[model samples]
Target: MSSSTQVSGTGVVAPPDSTGISIIVVGGGFGGLSCAIECKRKGHSVVVLERVPGLHIQGDVISFGPNAGRIIQRWGLHDKIWELCRHVDKLVLHNYLGEIVREQPLPLPLWGAWGYDGHRAEMHQVIYEYAVSLGIDVRFGYTVQEYYEDDAGSKAGVRVEAKGEVVSMEADLVVAADGVKSKARKYILGYDDKPRSSGYAVYRAWFNGQEQGVDTDPLTDYLTKGEDAFFGWIGRDVHFLASSAKGGKEISWVITRKNDFEVTDNWSFPGKMEDVLAVVDGWEPRCAATLAKAPSCIDWKLIIHDPLPTWISKSARVVLIGDAAHPFLPTSMQGGSQAIEDGVVLAVALQLAGKDNLPLAVQAWEKIRYLRVRESQLIGEDVRNRWHRCQPGDRGPMLDVPRPEWLFAFDAEVNAYEVFESVARDIRENGYNRPVLPPELAP
Candidate 1:
C-alpha cells in the first residue's frame, strides 16, 4: 500500500505523510487507537495490541473537549460521534438542599471547541472502528506481558500471547497506553511508585431510564423529560451528578464523597445502594428518588502517583502514553482528552524527527507534553478542594469549571507541526527538559 493511500470506501482521507516508520502501540483504548490512527494517517505502519478479548462499549459519560474535538474532526468522525452523543444542553448546579446554584448554558465557546460528552463506550467505538477502517492492525485477546527495547539494537517490542503461545512482535517504537496500573512503569521508572488515595471515591451507575423507572417516576421524570440534562449537587464533603442521555433512553449518575472504604491493592469494588443513600441522605429528594432506581454502582477510589520523572525509557524506543504515564484526578476531566493529544503530538513528532532521529523524537515528545499535562492535572486538585470547602459565597464563580482557551482551544496536530522543531532542537543542545514542581508538590 502506498504511504498516502486512503482505505477504499471509507473516505478516511488520512492526511498525507511520508514518515514510514513501523510502530507498535500497546493498548487499544482511546490513547492507543489515537496513536495508531494518527501514525497511520501520517503514513507510519502501526499495530495495536489490546489485552481485551473484543471491543466493549461498557462505560458511561466520557468527554472530548474541543482540543481533542479538533483531532476527531480531522479524522472525519465528528458528525458520526455527535449522533451517538447525549448533546447536553446545559449544566445545572444545585446545593445539597435542592436550591439551584447556577444553570450555565452548554458548549461555552472556548474557541469553537464543540466538546463531545457521552457514553464512554460509544465515543471509544467511534475511534476504534475508524482505526480498523483505515487498515490498521489491531489485535485483541493478545495480552502483553512485558515491554522491551534496545537502543543499541535500534528497535522496541512487546511479548504477547499469539495462537496460544507467547510471541515477540517488534517495531521501530513501542507505545504503552496501558492503563493507570500499568506494569510498564517498572521498565520506564526503574521502580514502580505505588498509587495513594486522593481521599475520595465515586459511586457510578448507568442504566436505561425507562427500564430503571426514572423516566416515568413522577419524582425523577424531570431528569429524562426533555433534552439531555446534566445536574450536579454539591454538599459538605460529597457531590452527586446525574444526567439523561440517548434522549432519555439512558440515565447516568455518580456520587463522589469521602472514601470510607479501606485502601488496598485494588482500588475499585462493588458499591452498595444503601451506602449511596446514606451519603446522599440530605441531598434533594429527587436525587435519592432517582438513585434508588439504580441497579448497582462501582465504588472507584481515586488514586494518584508522584509526578513521573520521565515518560520515555532509557532506550527512547519505548514510551508510555495516557493513564500509564500521567493518571489524572477525576476533577481533571481532560485525562482522556490529553491522552488523545499525546497520540496526535507523538505522531507529528516522529514524522518531523524522521526515522533516524527516533531517540530525539521520543524524548522530546515527553518534554513538550509534561508541563501542560501537569498544570491540567493540578486543575482537578484545585477544583476538588474548592468544591469540598464549598462556602456561601463560593457557589457562583468558584463552582464554575474554567474552560480556558490555552487548554480547550489547543490543536495538537497543528501545534506539533509548529513547535516540534524548536522543542526538538532544544532537547538536542540542552537535553530533554523536565519542569521543577512547585514547592508544595515537591518532596
Candidate 2:
C-alpha cells in the first residue's frame, strides 16, 4: 500500500492509493472503536480485532463531558447518544446522615452542553453501529499474541491467535487500544508495570427504582423525580454516588470504600447484599433502604499505574491509544472521555502528517495528548482523596470546586490539526521530549 499524499496546512488530504495506509486496531472497546471510526473517516483502511466474542458489558454507566460530546456530534452520533443519555443538571452532595451538604449545578454554558450519563454498553453499541456503517472491519474473538515492526521500520503489525490458528497480519500502522491490562503495552515497552491497588473497591448495582421497592423518600425523590441529578454521600473512608439513567427508567449507584482484604481487580465479582448494606450500616435510612432493595451487585477493585514514560514505540509505526496509553480512576469520569479525545487527536494527526510521515504524526499525537491526560489523571486522584477524606463539617467549595473550562472546551480534532505541523517539526528536529507543563494544561 502506498502512503497517502500529504496536504499542507489545514486542508484535508485526499485518500492515498486504493488501499489507503492499512491500520490494524487491537481491542474493540470504546477507545478502539472510536479510533477505528476516526481513522476510517480520514480515508484509511481500518480493522478492529477483539479478544472477546461480543461487546463486554461489564461496566454499568459512564459520563461524557462536552469534550467527548463534541466528537460525538462531529460523528453525527449526538441524536443517538442523546437518546440513551440523561442530561445531568446538578450534583448534590450529602453527609453520612443523608442531609444535603452542597448542591452544585453543572455549568452548562461553560461545558458547551449538558453533561451526559448513559450505560457504557449502549454507548459502545452506538459507536459499533457507526463503525459498521462506515464499512470498517471489526473481528471478534481474535487475541493478539505478539506485535512486530518490519525490519526496515516502515511498517508494523500484529500476530493473532484466531479460531485455534495463528494468523499474521501486517499493516502500515498499528493502534493498540487494548484496555488497562494491555498486552501491546508490554510488547512495545519491553516490560510490564503491574497496576498498583488504590486501596479502594467499589460495589455497584443498577436496577429500576420502582421495581427495586425503593420508597420515594426525599433522597430517592431528589435523585429520580426531576431533571437528572447525582446524589453522593461522603464518609470517613467511603463514598456513595447514585444517579438516574435513561430518563429515570434505570438508576445506578456505586459505593467506594477502603479495601481491607484481598480482592482481584476484575469488574465483575458477585457481592453479597448483606455486605454492602453493612458498609453503610448506620448512615441514613434511605441509603440503607436503597441498598437493601438492590437485586444484585458487583465488586470492582480500583487499581492504578504511574504515568507511562511514553505512549509510542521506537518504530513509531505501532502506538498505544486510550487505556492502553493512559488509564484513569473511576472518579475522573474521564476514562472513556480521555480515550475518545486520544482517538480523535491521533486520527487528526495522522491526517495532517499524511502516511509517509506516520512516525512524526504519532509523535505529534503523543506530544499534544500526554500532559492533558496526565493532568486529568492527577485530578482524578485529587478528587478521590478529597471525597475519601472529607469530614462532616466540610461543605460547599470544600466538597466541590468549579472545573476549568479548558478541560471541557477542547476540540481534539481541531486542536490536533492546528498544532500538528509544529509538533511534528519539533519531533523531527529534536527527539520527542516531555513538556514541563503543556500550554493546554497551563493554569
Candidate 3:
C-alpha cells in the first residue's frame, strides 16, 4: 500500500494542513460536487478531480422527492431551484393502453414539511455554480486511478491521471464519489465487482416545448400548465415514466423492462425512435401521439446490487459515498438524492467528531448512515419489482393510497446532523463497537 504522508507523482510537494484538514473529492458529479462544497464551507481546503471537462448536462428532468428538495434549499439554492424547475403537483399512473388508471396527488405535507421539488438542470447549475463561487479548486479531465490508505488507516488519498500526467495527491480525507463503477472504491477496499445488469433497459430523452408540442387535452395531460407531474405505465414486467422540465418547456421520459431482451450498458446510447413508438403500441391515442413526437431516445441497461450489510471499512479510514456506497435503480428516482444525503451526512459526522478523533468520527458516520441507506435501498428494489410488472397487478406500497409518510417527510439537512450526534453518543457510551461491514465493503 502507498503512504498518505506525501503527494507523489506531482513534483510539487503539496503540503498538509496546519490549521484545518484537506479533502480530495473524486468525481465531479452531483454527489462529489456537493461533498466538495460542504467540506469547504466547514473550513476545510478541498480539491475536486473530475474526468469530464466541465459539467455534462444530460437527462431531461430529474425528479427529487421532498427529502432531496430540502437539502437543496439548505444549500441556499432553493430560489434558483424553483426558478429553474416546473413544480409537479401530482403523479399519474397509466396502463399499457395509456388509460389513466390512478392519479396520486403530490404529498402536500411534503411541501411545507420537507419543502421543495427538484428540477435536474436547475439543480445541477445551482450546485456547480456554487462550488465554483466558493473557490473550490475543481480540475477537469483529471481521472482518478486508485486510492492509497495509510497502513495504520489514519489517512487516505488518491492518484489521478490529469492532463496526460499521473499525479498522486494526498489529503487528510478522501471521498470516493465516483459513480457505480468507482476506481477509488476498488483500490481502497480491493474489489472490482462491476455493477451487474438488472436485466432491464431504459429509454430516456428530453424534448423542447417548441418542437414537441404540448397536449391541451385535459384527459391526456398529466400536469396542468403550471404544475408538473410524473406519469407512468406499470405492468407485470415493464414500466415507463414521463414528466416535464423547466416549467413545461421540455419533457423527460424513461421506459424500463426486464432482461428477457438484451440492452446496452451506456445510459445515453441511442435507441431506434420507432422501437420506442412501438413500445407504447396500445397507449391512448393522445399519449401515443405525444410520445411519437419525441425527437430521439437514449437507451441504457439498468444495474443493481444486493444490500450491503454496512458501508464502513474495518480500518475506518476510507468509506464509500454516493453510488460507490449504494447504487440503486431508476425505479426509486432517488439516486442523486441519496448521493446528496451521503455527502452531507458524512460531512456532519466529521464535523461533530471534530478534528481530534478522525477515526472515531469515521466510525460514527458509518454507524448512523448504514441503516437509513439500507432501508432506502430495499425500498428502491421493491419499487423496481412493482414498476416493471408486465401484467396489471394491485399497486404495492409504491402506489399505495396515501403514500408512505417516511419517504417524502425526510429532511436530510436537519436529519443528517441529528443522526450524527445520536450515533456519536452511542459510540461514546459503548466504546468502539465494531458493526458488521457490508458485503460490498468487506475485503
**TM-score per candidate, chains pooled:** 0.94, 0.91, 0.84
Superposed Cα deviation of residue 414, candidate 1 (Å): 1.2
Model 1: per-residue lDDT, tens digit, 61-144?
Answer: 777788888888778887888877777767898888888887776664348656887888988988988998988989999888
166-240 in candidate 2: lDDT tens per residue? 999999899999999888888777897677777888899877777864436554665566556578888878888
1 against 2, candidate with superior TM-score = 1
- Candidate 3 has an lDDT of 0.67
A best-first ranking of the candidates according to their lDDT comes to 1, 2, 3
Tens digits of per-residue lDDT, candidate 3, 1-443, equal 26565332111122333226678888888889888876666555789988887676666556565677766666667777666665556677877776666777764436454334444656777888998987889988999887787787677777789788898888777888888777665564466555566777777777764455565655435433755666777665767777775556667677776554442344456788787777766666655555655788777767765544445555666667888878877766677878887877676666557667776777787776676676666666677765554345554344632335576677655665666667777888888665665565432
Cα lDDT for residue 63, model 1? Answer: 74
Clashing pairs in 2: none
Error of 1 at 1 (Å): 23
Task: Write down the lDDT that model 1 would get.
Answer: 0.82
Candidate 1's TM-score reads 0.94
The better candidate by lDDT, 1 or 3, is: 1
Q: Give the count of colliding residue pairs in each prediction.
A: 0, 0, 12
